[model samples]
Structures are given as structure tokens and as C-alpha cells.
Target chain A: MNSQPPAASTETSYGEAIRAGFVHLLSSHREVFAIGQGLWSPWYVGNSMTDLDKLFGKARVIDTPVSELACTGAAVGAALCGYRPIVIHPRMDFMVLAADQIINQAAKWHHMLGGQAIAPVTIRAIINRGGEQGAQHSQALHAWFAHIPGLRVVMPSSVADARDLLVASVLCDDPVLYIDDRWLYERKAVLPAVSERPLAAEGPRVVRSGTDITLVGAGYSSWLCEQAAEILAAEGLDAEVIDVRVLNPFDPAVILASVSRTGRLCVVDGGWRNAGWAGEVIASVAEALDPRQLKSSPRRITLPNAPAPTSRMLEADYYIDAGHVAAAARTMLAARETAS
Target chain B: MSHRHWQSELAGLADPAQYTAPLVIEAAQGTRLMGLLRSMLVIRHTEDQIGQLVVAGLARTPCHLGIGQEAVAVGVATQLRTTDRVFGNHRSHAHFLALGGTPTSLIAEVLGKASGTSRGMGGSMHLFGREFGFHGSVPIVGATIPIATGAALAAKLDGGDSVAVAFFGDGATEEGVFHESMNLAAVHDLPVLFVCENNLFSSHLDIELRQPSDRISRYAEAHRVRSLTVDGNDLLAVEAAANALITGIRQGAGPALLEAVTYRFRGHVGPNEDIDVGVHRRMADVSAWKRRCPIKRLSEGLLAAGIVSGDELAALEREVVAKITDAVTLARRADYPDPSALHDLVYACRP
Candidate 1:
């Protein structure tokens, strides 16, 4: 069991890494660019997208006119015309405004055209930060995108992984959903190297390893699980924490491999609990592995079905903190120990 | 004299006794116009065949056939090119055919065969032809209009002379996005053309019953877009409107509107003109529309001009029927999409 994470994978916060990576890609490729409402503005909202406009030029580092729907449609149009636009929706909450462009157009165009047209557009959506932004802003809607068939949904938790995943997403020949939360961007880590041959790269790259228990996490929650693993490791628990960077085309091979050995799994997604991405992962794991392989039942930690709370106090009270994640992992391990 | 050969209801629209002006067949327009006429005829015939197929339980798709609305597509597409982007609504057979998509693929898609435009997945509603600049024709009423506007903005940004066209029905105007799109296109001066087929019935309710005024061009005027109103069944009128608007767009003029005042012989939903009609548009109105057949009018004018003899016109009709028959047969025999194709097309198959 390769319990120890490689030093190469360790880096700065997921946010900084993603921004640095985007700046690098935008600088290297002219056709590639970043566009959003606060992307290249004087007041940069998505932390990773700061200073991108100055480095990449105004044409590439575009600032939209507070129109999510228009910009997304423009991005799709630009992509169809051969320009790879890395459109930033900034907040997952605003994606509802762009639903027509996302669902009816972007996701269905290639198939509608009988695969003659492939929109190589990448949208970076900030999601599930568990902030005081309330129902309007704080949302983990990765599952919404994951449910869509044509889009490649990505959720990067760590800085280095954020850069790697986003760079990889841009190279994809189809539309990709590169989502990282507002809170996750400021969280720094080491930078990871990029895959040069992205065309051959299919989906979800596993960034962490474990044997005793699988801690499946993505976006900010992945980091939460990693922090939780440290607290559990001190108590002599060998928990395998897997950062589910790519959410939509979830890598079953890596996930199943980790779960097969561990025999215990816990999916921690910041999305709403009832039918969040955690449910999808849990369901998929159960379907893929035989019942006998399980030493303990898989579990999940997610947001309650209610709308995100409004006040900062309520937000802090409701956040799925590292302590909550550790306790969940501890409970899983205890359950397995009891079963055995 | 315009030979009034319309169905019983449409006979009064024009006087058969008086001479109706020739639709004309100039030296340059003969070959291309003939091709356009044949394309519209193919669409009309395919829908008729699909109507039968639906009854025979061969096809399960709910096809919105624009049989009487052929002139709109043929007329507008005559001015379009491989570079211009086009978006269509649920009834987009002529839209696809006008942009040069194969009749076989159209029939194959409607038949839910793998040889379909959408590989049998999207059926009748969703069709696309990007290589030929037919972006997509979706079922969502006014969804693609804004997309076309965005595409027009992109063309302008890229410094391309290409224009984007949105082919939607009068019902689609009710969508908020349609107004927003027109406003954006006009203010941005994007090279986009809005072609509204005001067939007067959105699903069942008449345009008059819905809007305060019967003229949808009023909305275009509200957006400050240069507008044109024409008889949709007149192929020459459609062509003239399309040519003028397309030319204006390519010349860097902002978005323009061309509203073709026409009527569909069929019902709102399918090949049958009988179902889904409101209490207002009577059988008499549909029968009256028969006198305004764009194909018949053009053929009569051509026959009178000696540009085409009666035998030549007959030969053309026979050729169209034979071609459509062949396309249908080929489409029917074509393969269905493999299951593996289902997963691959959704995401970017980078390899």
C-alpha cells in the first residue's frame, strides 16, 4: 500500500496553483484565454485569475459585462470558431443564468450535429466554499454538471492539482467544466507538472493514495479530507485519501482500486447532501465492487438539503471542517473495526 | 395569367382569370433556383412520407413539418454560405436541406437510423451541419437565437465576413432571450439576421390571438433593426428579402429582420394539417393558402416565359420525386448508431 503521498504531488494552495497554471497556459498559447466578470478586473474575484489579464493581454484576459449567459454563449461561439476560451463563471450560483447556453447548446451541439462539431471550450466555475454568501452564492453544484453528459466536469481541491487539472482540461477537444471553490483558491500547495500529451488523457487522475479506508473528496472538501487524514493517522489509522479532481468522468479505476483494498469508503462532498456528488460516488462504488469486498459500509458527509445559510456565523457553524471530516473518518474506521 | 391550381380553400387568394406577374427565371438563377426548389420539394415529400411512417409505426418521432413554409428556408438559404452560421427551431427540415445537408441524413434522423444527422439520437428536432455552417436546430423554441447572436459577435471579433442567422417561428418571440438577443445584436452591430416565419399559429393560438398586432416585424422595429415583410409562400420574395438582409449583414450593417408572412398547410405538430389547429384558423383558411403554392407559382411563371416547358417542369418534378425516393431508401437501409457511440460524443474524445 503506497500510503505516503509523493513529494512531487505536494505544492501550494489549489487556488494559487490554478492561477499560476492558467497564466502559464494563457501566455504560452494565444488561442487560449480567460474571460469572466471579475477575472481581469481591478478587483479580481476568482483568486487564481488575478493578474492574468496583464500578463496575457486584454484580448485573452477578457472581462465580461456582468452577463453570465451572454459570456458563456460567446465562449461557446469562440470555441466553435477555433479559439479555446477558458470562461470563468466565478460563482456556481450564477450558473443558472447560463443554463440555456450550458445545457441546450454546449452539451448538445456536437451530438446534435452528429459529432461533426466539437466545442473545445473550458468553463472554470467557482463552487461550494461554505461561506457567508448564503443561498445565492455558496453552492457545490458539481453534480449538476456531472449529470450533464456532453460536458467534462472537473473539481480540483489542491493548488498543484488545480493547475494540473485545469491545464489538462483546456487541452481537451470538448467542453470541460473546471470548477474550484473561492475558498480553495487561496489554499496554497506545491505546483504539479502538466501533461504534454493531453489528447490521449481520458479522465480523473488520482492524486493521493491509501489502503485502510478511501476518503473520496473533491474541490475544497478534498483538502478537508487530507487534513482529516492527518488527524486520523496520528491515531494509527491508515486511511487512503483520494482527491477526486475530475468529478464528471469520475475515474472508476483509481477509485475502485483504492476501495477494493480498504474495504471501507467515505465520500465527502460539499454539495447538498440529498443527491450530491457524494451520493453518485457512493452508488458507483457499490455498483462496481462486489458486496463481499466490503469490510464496512461506505459513508458520506455532505451539506443538508436546506439552502446555504446567510450569516457568517451560521456559515462557520455549518462548514464541513477538518474536525468534522476527521470524526467521519474515525467513525468509519471504528465501524469497520467493530464489524471485523 | 397565374394558373390557380390551389385546393378548394386557397382559390380565392388570387384571381385565375387575371394575369399574375411572372416569378421570373433569369439566366443566372435557373440552375441554383431549380436546385433550391428541388430541395424544398424533397423536404415536403419526406415529411409526407414520415407522416405515413408514423402511422405505420415505423417512426416514433414527433416531426414538426414545415411543408407550406418551404419558401422561407429555400429563399433565405439561397443567400447563405458554408461560413455563415444558422440556427433553427423544431421545424428545421428545410433549414437543414437549404444549407445543403443530405436528404438521406434528414430522413435517416427522422427514421431514427444511425445514418441520421444526429446518429438517431436527436430524432427530428435536433439537427446540425457545422461543416456546411448549419450550427444546430434545437427543439427549445427561442434558445438558438441568442446563440446565433453570440456567434455573430464572434464573427465580427474574428474579422470574418460571415453572418449568423436564427430561423425561428413567431411563437419563439415570446421568449425573453429573443428580445435580449435582438437588442444585443443591434447595439453591438453584430452581423446577424433574424428570420421569423410568422405562420400566424404558434402551436395552436393564432399570432393575432397572441400579439396585439399580427406583424412580428414590429418587435424587430422596436429593436431598431432594419425590417422587411414579405409573403412567405412567394419564393422570389423570400429570396429578395434574404439577399438584401444577407448582403446588408456582410457589409458590416448590424442585425436585420426579415419576417416572412406565410402559412403552414400542416398542423402545428406533425405531417397532418388537421390536428392541433385552433378554433380560429379554419379548414377554409388552409385550403385558401393552397393557391399561394410557391413552387406552383414559380413553375407557372417559368412555363409562361418559355424558360422551361411543361415537359421540362414535369421532368423536374419526376426527378425530384425519384431523388427523394432514393434518399429515403438509402436512409432506411443505413445502420443505427452503435451503443459505444453514445458515450464518446458527449465528452471531448481528445485522441
Candidate 2:
């Protein structure tokens, strides 16, 4: 944890920053088009597509019918034919309907066709959770998209990344799955300007530096780690927070280096507990670090392997937040204390 | 209940040799009948050579032969230019040759040579030749229908008269992408031509068992798109249907569907036509269908129209045979790719 208190930033939330990013992207590239259902209506409140259809007209900001498979396939086809299309799946669960086009066609075209084509399309699939919505609506399926080889999966944890990563994903010359979590939309932070160009390829960034423990988080989980870092700081327990923005081409050098120093790690993610993206990160650190490097065993804070419940209390207990992350770090510290 | 109606409506097209009447070309000069004849002949000879390779154990891949259905490809390809995008499915040998793809490259691809269309990575099922405007082909049925629609949308965005064509089988119509693509094309008024080759059987299972009807144009009609069902064996009919559709598509009228009723001469895959797994195709049906060969029909038409005599037809066959023989020899001699190149073509050359 830092010696000084964190500085106060602007009041713009991640959702607002993301919407401005869309306006910038649409105005920047004439070939770029954003197509999905309910984009122009209030149903897409945090969609970052406010007034895009009016500004760019219906042709550019295409309002498609309720067809995920056809629309996703159309985006892939459009990308192949020299168009940069950002296809939005307002809810990530419905993206399963388009698995054929996403996994088989969009992801495989470049490699299977022997580089004869480039599907430079960006799929903006949102992970909406925390509500009383039932099983169908509240699921984080980023791990499945990360499992594919030809795709670049990015989970933005901060408002800056939400803006910059969208810009980067659209500019990338390959199929990119830009996974956004709705929980982080209300979190406010300083973001890049709409016209500012960010790095095309960014690795994991160490947001908060510490030495006692290395806390890893992806998307909303990264924000959770930041909150946990504050709690750990109050207890005089220094904890390092690393935001894993890119999941597919994950370079664990930073995590391994932090683990080598801290000798303990806690992975926080919004995915299933068993066989999740957090597990992959934890396993990588365990494999890369020596056995003696760890003062205590690694820990993972993820959702239980069950469908989301409709009750408010059940929803509260199911999701992992800042308090859960801090508790996980404390448990690791207690175990090390007991052993010592 | 609709099943019975579908059966009666499709009963007229159930026979394999429904339109086996030999074509007698009346006037061949102004219509470019000679080029059409040559194109069909090339496709027939190409598939024939591929069958020989599969039987000789030289081609080590699934060679889906469209031996009896060459006219469907040649007809559609005749009306297409180098800029018009076209996609094909597993049974795409005739589609490749008809689009002016050289025999040497295609045969080399089948033989897994380094100089093949996919650089030996995609055997016979996956083919890619952008120069000739055959964008790409995959083994997955109906996979390219939406992709072709995307290409057509791209053409429209580019503000050009170019159109996109998707060549698939009757089996592909059963896939959701086919219907989705038709709807998308119609909604966007994309310049796309959905060409369905209704060969009755979809890999040994008859269309009757799979669908309520044998005709695929009905699906197009459901999408409110213009469609035409033609005798796939007759080159003129297929071309005329495709020409009208392509012209309208170019004029920004919208998407159109052309269902070419044809039959595969050989089994679903490989050389032998007599061997089938389920509901064996009667030998009489196979023989009668062969009598309606696209190449033979065009040849007879050309001969009758005084375009070429019997001796000329025989000489053309000999010439095609010689070219195929040379392509095979070259393909056999072509080198296989180095093992280190396994990961090379997976991505484009990064700039």
C-alpha cells in the first residue's frame, strides 16, 4: 500500500467514459459500425451507444433484430469484407447462441483459411450481474472466450481501460472479445480523452504497489482488489494489486515477480470457482514460483459453481466483492502466522 | 400435414433423371455457347481426374465429387466475374474449376502440395482463391452463406455493382445460418445470390427423410426473396436463372435464390457411385442420371448447333485429358511443406 492517501479524481463513471469512447470511435472511422438490438432505446442504458444512431444515422449505428447468431455472423462477414464492426451482446449469456460464428467462424477463419482473411471485428459482450436476475441473465463466461486461441480477450477493470481497450480492440487486426462487467460501471476514475490514442497492446498493470501479498483481479474483480488494498492498508498489511486486463495473451511475469517477493497470492475473478480464469492465473504463479518462495498457499475468490439465484440475500452471498477479497488475504496471513 | 403437401409438390422433381432430354443447341454463335461448353467440360474432366486420384490412392483426402452436377457450378460461374465473391461447401471441386481455378493448383491442393490454394493446409474440403473471386470454402455445411452475405453488404457499402454468391447443397438449407443469411440479405437488400444445389440426398439420407419438401426455393420464398428452381442438368437453364438473379442483385433489387435441382453421380464421398450406406440408390437411377450428364448434354447441343462436329468434341475431351494428366504429374512432383511451417500461415504477416 502507498504511504499517502489516494488523490480525489473526477466524478465521471466508467459507463460515461465508455459512452464517450463509442462516440469517438464512430466519428473516427467511417468504416466502423456498431450493430445490435436495443442500442438506441433505454434498454441499453450503460451501453455506451447514447445518441450514436442519431449522430451517425441508422446505417452506421445499425439497430438489428433479435438474432444473436445472424448478427454475430454478419459482423464476422462484414469484418472479412473490409469493415470494422463492433457487435454488442447486451448480455453475455446470449452470446452462447452465437458460439458457432464466434468460435468456429470468427476465431478460426484467419488460421483455418491459412491467413487468406482477417476478421478484425470486436465483440462487446457485457457481463451483467448483482441484480435479482435469474440464471439466464447473470453469468460471466469470459473464461470460455479466453480458451479459444485466435481471439484476444480483454477484461477492463478501470474506466481508463474501458475507454482505451475498446479503442485498441477496434483497431486490432484480429478478432477481439471485449468483455465488460456491469458492476464496474458506477466506479469513477480518471479516463483518457475521447481523441487520445492508447497503447494497442497492454499487458497487466500493477495498480497498487505492495510487498506483503500480491492480489490479482480481472475486470470488476480488479476494482475489488483496489478496495481490499485499502482495508489491508488500514491494518498495516501491505498488499500489491495487479489488474489482469488481457486474459488470452496473459504474461505472468509481473505476477510471478510480485509473487516471488510477496510469497503469497490471492486471485479474484467473477467466474466459477472450479476451473475458472482465476485458477489459470493461480496455477501459473504456482508453477513459475519456487516452492520455498511462498510463505503460504495461494487462494482464489470466485463465484460458486451454481446458477445465480433470484433472492437478494443469495445474490449478495454469491458474488465476490471487496470484503471477500480482504477476508481471503487475512486468512492467508493468519495461516502464515500460525505456521511461523 | 404440410409434409404431404410438400411431398406432392416435390414428387415432380423426385426422379433423378427428370429432365434427361438431350439438348439440341439451335444457335450457339451470339450466346458464347462454346465457352460455356468448354467450362462445363473442364469441370467434368477435373472431377473425373480427382476421382481417378482418389481411387489410385494418390489423393489422401475426402474428395467430394460433383461429377453429375458440373452444370450447376459452370452455369453460375459463367455469369460471374472476377470481382463477384463466391463461397462453396465440402463438395466444391466443380465450383473451383468452373471459376477458372487452374487444375494444377487445385490438384496440388488435393495432393497436399506446398503450392496448393491453402498451401497444403486445407486439403480438398477447404479451398481459398481470392484472385479468381472464390473467396473461401469450408467443410462445414452452410457456414459460408452468412459470410457471402457479409461480402455482399461490403460491396453495397463500397457502392459497387458487385455481388456475392454462396454455393451450397440441399443439406445446407437445413442449417440455421442459411435461413438467417437469407433473412439478413433480404432485410438489408444485399446483393447476394444464394445458390442451393438440391441433389435430393444429403450424404446418403434422402431430403424427404430430412425435410418436408425436396425444393429449397420455398425457404427463400418464406423470406420474401425472389427465387427460381431450374433443371440443374441443363447448362442454359441454370445460366439463365443465375443471370436474371445476378442482374437484379447488381441493380440493388435485393437478394435472390436459385435452387438448381441436380444429383451427385458418385457416392457422397470418393470414386465409387454404386456404394451407399442407407437407402441404396438404384443402379437404374444412376445409369439414367448419367445419361443426363452436363458435359455430354452441352457437347450434343454444340454439335447439333454446328458449333463443333463429333470429331471436335472428341478432340476437346482428349485435350482436357492431356491437361489433367499434366496437372496430376506436376502435383505428384510438387514438394510437401516443411514441418516448421505448421504455424506460419495461421496468421497474416504482421506488419
Winning model by TM-score: 2
Instruction: Say which docking band candidate 1 falls in.
Output: acceptable
- The positional error of residue A262 in candidate 2, measured at the CA in angstroms, is 1.5
Residue B151 in candidate 2 has what lDDT? Answer: 83
Model 1 agreement with the true structure over A1-340: per-residue lDDT tens digits? 1134448756566666776678667767667877667866655565566677676667667776666776787677777767778878767888778888887788878876667777788888777455467788877788888888788888777666677777777877788888877776567655656554463354544555667788888878888888888888889888788877767656677888888988988988888887679999999899999999988888898877778898888777677888998897788778766867
Per-model DockQ: 0.36, 0.48
**Interface-residue RMSD per candidate?**
2.4, 2.5
Worst 10 residues of 1 chain A by lDDT: A196-205
Superposed model 2: Cα runs more than 4 Å off? A1-9, A45-47, A194-200, B1-11, B277-279, B347-351
Local lDDT at A57 for model 1: 67
Model 1 residue B192 CA deviation in Å: 1.9
- Model 1 per-residue lDDT tens digits across residues B1-351: 122331222232222322234576776677766677677777777777777777777778888888778889988987999988888889998899888888888889988888888778788898877778888788887877877876786687678699999999989988877887787678678899999998877998866556665677889879899989887877888889889988988998889999887778888876666666443447676776766777677776666666667887788778877888888789889888888777666665744
Report how far residue A7 has shifted in candidate 1, in Å. 18
Q: If scored against the real structure, what TM-score would every candidate get?
A: 0.88, 0.94
lDDT, candidate 2, A1-340, per-residue tens: 1124334554667876677667778888877888777788855747466777887888887877677887887788789888989999988988888888888888777776666788988999988886797798879998888888778789988888888888878877788899888888888876545544433347788999999999999999999999999998999889999999989766898899999999999999899987799899989998888899999889889899999988999998888879889999998988878888
